[model samples]
Target: MSLSEEPIAPTPTTQQDAPSGFEETESVNTSMQEFHQLYQKLLVITLVLTGIIFISVWIFYSLNTALNYLIGACTGVVYLKMLAKDVEQLGAEKNRLSKNRFALFVGLIVLATQWHDLHVLPIFLGFLTYKATLLVYTVQTAFISDS
Candidate 1:
């Protein structure tokens, strides 16, 4: 066929950069939502466990010790929330994870050390409650099947 007589095939449009399904962006949104939900669940678990443990500690140990633990637990909750926020913002607003979270730990330890009233062990253990919550979540997700 002659050049003028040949049928011209349509070219792909660059304007619509994404696929029709927008799977890439959609998956990101879905995963972010899942991460948010996971954060909420973990927060709830941490709070519930904190309350129970705080009460148990108060009953078994002493009110002062429990209060110390409470302080640490509160810090842990803040730290957890900050971590989630950083993770959510990762690669977007910020190129790397900020070291601000570590500052929270450092400040906690410093305060615990300086304050005669605050016992280092209890406060430190309380801060680790979040870690325990994470372990619980991992176990729940790994070992147990969704009902």
Candidate 2:
């Protein structure tokens, strides 16, 4: 039989039997969605924890302290969001965004430090709350697998 006379193979008619690259892209999209969902869950958890802490402090201490803590926690959340955006960028844009983030962080720290009425510890702790979300995500990904 000549090459031109050879029979052509049938193409996949279903998604499951599609090309490996297509499946891989689908998996990547699925994982991206999962990551986003997990990130949102973690963000909510962090906010709730911060709110609880703030309320407790407000009841025991003064309103000013509680407000400061709340402010710090909110700022931390904002910073985390900004950092995520920066991370999503590539090359020069990423570097620029990263530098801007760092500068903003430093400025906030300085401003908070200069504010004599605001307690440093609470503000600092509040700012670090976002790290808890990252830690939770790390632990989850380490233990959990898509398979």
Best by lDDT: 1
Instruction: Tell me the RMSD of model 1 versus the true structure.
Output: 5.2
Q: What C-alpha lDDT, on a 0 to 100 scale, does residue 30 get in candidate 2?
A: 95
**Per-residue lDDT of model 1, residues 17-92, tens digit only:** 5575676678889999999999999999999999999999999999999999999999999999999999999977
Q: For model 1, what is the alpha-carbon lDDT of residue 106?
A: 93
Report how far off residue 143 is in candidate 1 (Å): 2.9
Candidate 2 residue-wise lDDT, 1-147, digit = tens: 999999999899999879999998898779768767766887787887788888998999889988888877888888877776675564535455546766766776788889788777778777888887678667777888753
lDDT of each prediction vs. the true structure? 0.92, 0.78
Model 2: weakest 10-residue lDDT segment is 87-96
**Best by TM-score, which number?**
1
What does each candidate score in C-alpha RMSD? 5.2, 4.8
